[model samples]
Target: MLDSGLYEQLHKALWVQKKLSETVARHWVTTEYQGLTLSSHFQPIFSISHRRPVGYEGLLRASTDSGALIPPPAVLVLPNNSKENLELDRACRQLHLQNFARQETGDCWLFLNLNSQCLVTEQPDAGFMNRLFETTGIHPSRLVIEILESEITDRSYLKQLIKHFRSLGCLIAIDDFGAGHSNFDRIWELEPDIVKIDRSLVQEAGKSSRVERILTGIVSLIHEAGSLVVLEGVETRREALVSIAANADMVQGFYFAKPQQLISSNHEEFVSVIDELLQHQQRQRFKNTHQINENFRKIERLFKRAINHFSVTQNFEESSEILFAEKRSVRCYLLDDAGYQMARNIYSPHYQQTMDVRFTPLLSGDNANWSHKHYHFRAVQHPGQMQLSRPYLSVADSRMCITVSQTVTSSDKQFVFCCDLDWQDN
Candidate 1:
């Protein structure tokens, strides 16, 4: 007979052995999918500030017995069973981590793509992932899980999943952002560490100025929300410049390097390219700033001439007529020292007929106070100098316009002479 203590110890040993064997078997099964050997390719993610490769995203690749490459999308297709999908997901992750371990990555992060379906259907086993990380000698902080923005359905559940991964010291990234079904509401809720702008946006921005403006605004908004932006799929120098202009923190695309089996040791080469791009961007920004300053000077001269004429004639209509004859001023109005309108707005003949009925109430000179307006206060501060307001909605015409105002003292009475200029003209 066996002692109870001895039997208990033997039973515990058997359980540990069984678990280890199962883990190994599971790993072995992932090495091949349907007789095809699975592999991973790395694409470098470059940081604009660093001007070098900061990370590499691991992309899954598969090949057949004869070494024919299979399409990436085909590999993601799984059987109806959720367990099968989970197995494939684990296999891809294992291969990525193994490949990254074997390579000389050198203090850079490894971004791994996570299938949205598997994330929702087969929840991650934290213990298994931790053990795998320990076995591979990869720190959890070095791993970034990239999730497709379009695949997220349950906001609350996704938030919880993000929380779980964050607890494990893994960073979260929203991939293919602005591709389809882009809901900034969910983005705010998830609060991902990184947001990758989609390839389509980058491509379109290269072709259309309007699209570029929108992309720039989106990047600015994302930065304001405390998330780093990665401009993806930059295939040309123009596209990369567009990304730089938009103030993207990172860029990943063919312009840098295509997906490869090994991380290309071309850090110095890329640094040179980024430096040139940075210089070009700086020159362009400087040129734009100079042009804007010139325009401001010209507009100031026009406003000063109009103020001189208004101060002499003390006639809003005649002064506005003279200003509009130059085809720049949209409307002119007068406000007393207390910021109360002194007379009705004198509309430019060119824009007089285009005024919307909704803005009719603004034509009245009663109770309209300009004291709190930036242009009003700024002009008052300078007294005689002209001040230009940033673009704003014009009350008289309900169009985007910039106001140029100057405070003038004519016949012992102080008044603010204001002119509305079309924003498009500026």
Candidate 2:
């Protein structure tokens, strides 16, 4: 360790410059703090389309002199004095940068976790990280500053800190989204370059199709907000497949690789993993497409017959009985060209038994305008061609269902014929 005089000199030189003493090893950098060893480990983040590692998130590892490990939570617990916490956070960041500088990562980013304490305590324009970047010879563009936006209560301070980082050419990422009290407001306000979805959401997706669809919507919304989505904590093949199906931009977790000090040179290992996942997704997509086509064929036959009968006799119930004969059919209805319901829904007997009385107010569809729905507008857009919508929660019965619709011109009046099918089983 350097003497006290040399320590100040190194601090002036913009080295780690904290309470910890740094020791540069051959392959990595290490620091000593209260008799524990601090080191950096990285978990790879791979782009789904690129089929290779796009970047790595730096994780701090704390161990005893004898190599006994310490849990990350215990290691990162805030000290009673906020000053010590800030120093530790900066020290860990510097350690990560130094180790990353030695790796052969080639144009990939180094994602560093930024503690809320550091953001609150430091001056935004202090140029501390800029000086550190100069000392380590790492460009600011190569760094991704990860912040848990929920932890910072002061939106102004958070924005100022992010602005300062962006001014330095560092990419900003909202970390742990969808965990607790996370909303799209910050995403709209901060407009981060990347958003890391919390692991719990992905885990729940593996067990529930509803959660999986919700995940896909979340990813779509994030994309609409102009940020890439990274699904973290993917530990199983099922979770990885879910990520792919959800259209996540990137993924990171134990399923791909665990955190380690050395970056691997063999990129093909991860490429093969991505290739296999893509193949599985393609196969599943083909199977689902085939099933949906068969369903549409059956529904098409019944729908045309129903349309013909209703057109001539003007009887909704008698015409829709054939459609209600399908086991999955829930209800059938008709809408005018402007999307106002022309009549009450004809509910299948089996579906009527399972209706939730709590949603009785929404049971009647007469005069309700469904112009905003995809089923209505899509049929209007395609004219005579049938439209099938993805499964969505139906307000009429408060159950998950898919809608099949087609526009029909009968007796010179245009109508949109729609049928809902129970999606709980299929």
Candidate 3:
């Protein structure tokens, strides 16, 4: 619901929009221009945590008098001048508002796309939205003004217009934020409440694991910037999983629902989709965890054996023989209490054969200081306990590996025994 005071202020502030009271009716509002009829269709934007639609993005649907449809991209150009642009933009909003008001909107928002040209226009009249809100009995707070900041060249004017919208108590969203020419500069300047990620990013994330990680990082950055993320164009189950993995706050696409003339009240269908995705994710996580534990159990046995042998014989290479027998074990080395390497790395026969000679300079870590590594500090922090580090690229072989470190004392001096196990398979 919109706030009454906000509507009062808006109605008093401006009158730029063309009057549409005659066109407005009980169930819908339509504007005719150049023999074409314009109406509004809504596509839902769902909240991942809420498992329900938090809003619907209002899209324009234009058709000829003969009932042939005109794509929305072509509809914007129907208005030639700034005045016509303002009129069409306002008419579209009025139509969306009236139709949306007739539904059980509850507290969900109505996302309206404001033309950039109309936003920057120096037209005299204002208060169109104000009068519309008053007429439709929909609160301004329920409105979300989506602006494609990249299209507006006059950023100062854009900022002022956004500020005005904010003053009217409408939420602001930066639409298609990950598309061409879009940058964080507008996000920093406008400080929008929501940033809708472009579908291209969603498509790329679904195609590549590296892109999936990047998408997660991008979502994290947006959250840090104090705005929620809406991953748009999630058209498949894989893309939906990517959205969840990226931690996007909301999702909108054909995977859940498509744009329609009427809003669907059946939220259980959307809930079921999200429920199944979560279940699949949970199963995958359990399987990964179980596999990691099983692998660790085998490696730990060999690691303990090596440590015991080294403690008795004080021979690094001889003791590491048992560990090297594992196909995944890359190398083992001893480090002093201060993290200085105590011996040259004892590599597995497999590593020696497949090792890249280009990294010959880094192959021998004897006398190298590993104090800066997380595995070293973690092992030092908890003496006598095994520390398992997350998989990372090993500086020694340039291959991905997980480090298992344990601190042990020999001859009254502490030493850290560390082994690198290849993580390419798991």
Candidate 4:
């Protein structure tokens, strides 16, 4: 083991690194990313899918007062000094405003790492955030306060802090989620707007099912609670695609763009990239919409014909084969009034297993039983509601889809029919 002198020396070395990071962060206004001279120190890496604003993550890189880009992460891990951390945060905010102004974009929130000490000091300067907003001309709505999950985090105060930020019109985010031992339960208590999946959890998405399951559970849990997920530190198309398929609302990683002291210009190239994504989304959307419309029309026609079938013998074994059997892909299920499974198309891969399925989750809505699923033609729609299940991958075919449940009442007796729509086959 090292002696006290060596330990002290190491601490001093850490402080030196800390000071260098501050120097670099202080120069954030002059950092460049991909040749785009960011007028600010904080750089935002975004999702390539919808061009929707994710969060602007602060990067502690600095082009020298001498013009050299200081490395990141090390700058952050040098030493956890509260005062220094606060200063770093402030400088990051300043640079964040500068970059916000340059982009001519107003919706993306700037996610500045927060110093836990600064939060619990019982000394929130009322004007601090407002002034930062005023200086940056970034609206409070466009600011997200990012709290790193550290040992010192106190859940009670964290809740208070998140509520306080929200009171100021700013959003709250939990950064580096699932990386450390902090209480993720606070996320639910605080009701934050964003829950960023830590890079470590996302790093081995391809090789480790264990990693993927953990990542899946984290993302799914956050999404279930109504918060958006940003798959942070995405480094590969595979990672991004997997996260996207898992329903992540946003993604950030080096593959998209690395943090730089300066941002790359050539707006034309960025614009073209944006255009291509938009066109692809548009076409995909069109195809999905067309498929759903055709299904709806077919369903309407089938339902009119099936009304006689519904009124007759409840078991579809004979008539369904005579009617929908020719249609191949369409699926249907029946549930009794007591929430028990009934029957469905014999060909349905899941036929007769159970009326209540696992793939879709139902939610309550305007009608006693109406819900929506995400579809190609429509991002979300209730169609005709029985008990609407949110979208999920169908277990039978492993395809993205949603199931709609509705009750058909003849003379006050109610019977439920749940219809499933698969985007893959569509």
User: Best candidate per TM-score, number?
Assistant: 2
Q: What is the C-alpha RMSD of each candidate to the true structure, in Å?
A: 12.8, 9.3, 9.0, 14.1
Q: Which lDDT tens digits does candidate 2 get at residues 1-426?
A: 899999888777554422112332455789987778999998999999998889999999999978899987888774556677788888898899989887778999999998877658656444678888988888999999999988889999889989988989999999999999999999999999999999999999998888999999999999999999999999999999999999999999999999987776567888988999999999999998998888778877888888778778778789889898787889999999899999899999989888888998999997799999999999999998878898889989778899989888878899998899899944
Clashes of each: 0, 0, 7, 21
Stretches off by above 4 angstroms in model 3 are 1-26, 81-83, 117-126, 153-158, 185-189, 312-322, 330-373, 392-401, 424-426
Tens-place lDDT digits, model 4, residues 1-426:
999999999999788767755654564355443332323444454655556445566555544455665565444444356655565555556666665555534465677777666455544555877887787677888777787756445677667677778888988888888787746676777777888888777777745644665577777888888888887887775676556545677777775666654343323443464456556656767996797667566655555444446646555454344335323333655444554445533444433343345433431111222122232112122223434345567544455556545555545555655556554422
Task: Evaluate residue 206 in candidate 1 and report its C-alpha lDDT on the 0 to 100 scale.
Answer: 96
Question: Who is ahead in lDDT, 1 or 2?
Answer: 2
User: What is the clash count of model 2?
Assistant: 0
lDDT tens digits by residue: candidate 1, 196-303: 999999999999866887899899989888899999999999999999999999999999889987665558888988999999999988997897678677666666
TM-score between candidate 4 and the true structure: 0.53
After superposition on all CA atoms, how large is the RMSD of candidate 2? 9.3
Taking all chains together, the TM-score of candidate 1 against the true structure is 0.82
lDDT for model 4: 0.58
Instruction: Give TM per candidate.
Output: 0.82, 0.91, 0.81, 0.53
Candidate 3, residues 1-426: lDDT per residue as tens digits? 669998877775443121232223345767886788988788999998999999999888989977999998788887778888888787788888988887766899999988877757654234877888898898989999989888888888888888888878899999998899998788887899999999999999999876787799889988988999999999999999999989999999999999987676668999999999989988988998998899789888988888888777788898888898788889998998789999989899988888899999889996799999999999999998889998787998787789999987777778999999887732
Question: What lDDT score goes with residue 360 in model 4?
Answer: 37
Off by over 4 Å in 2: 1-27
- lDDT value for model 1: 0.83
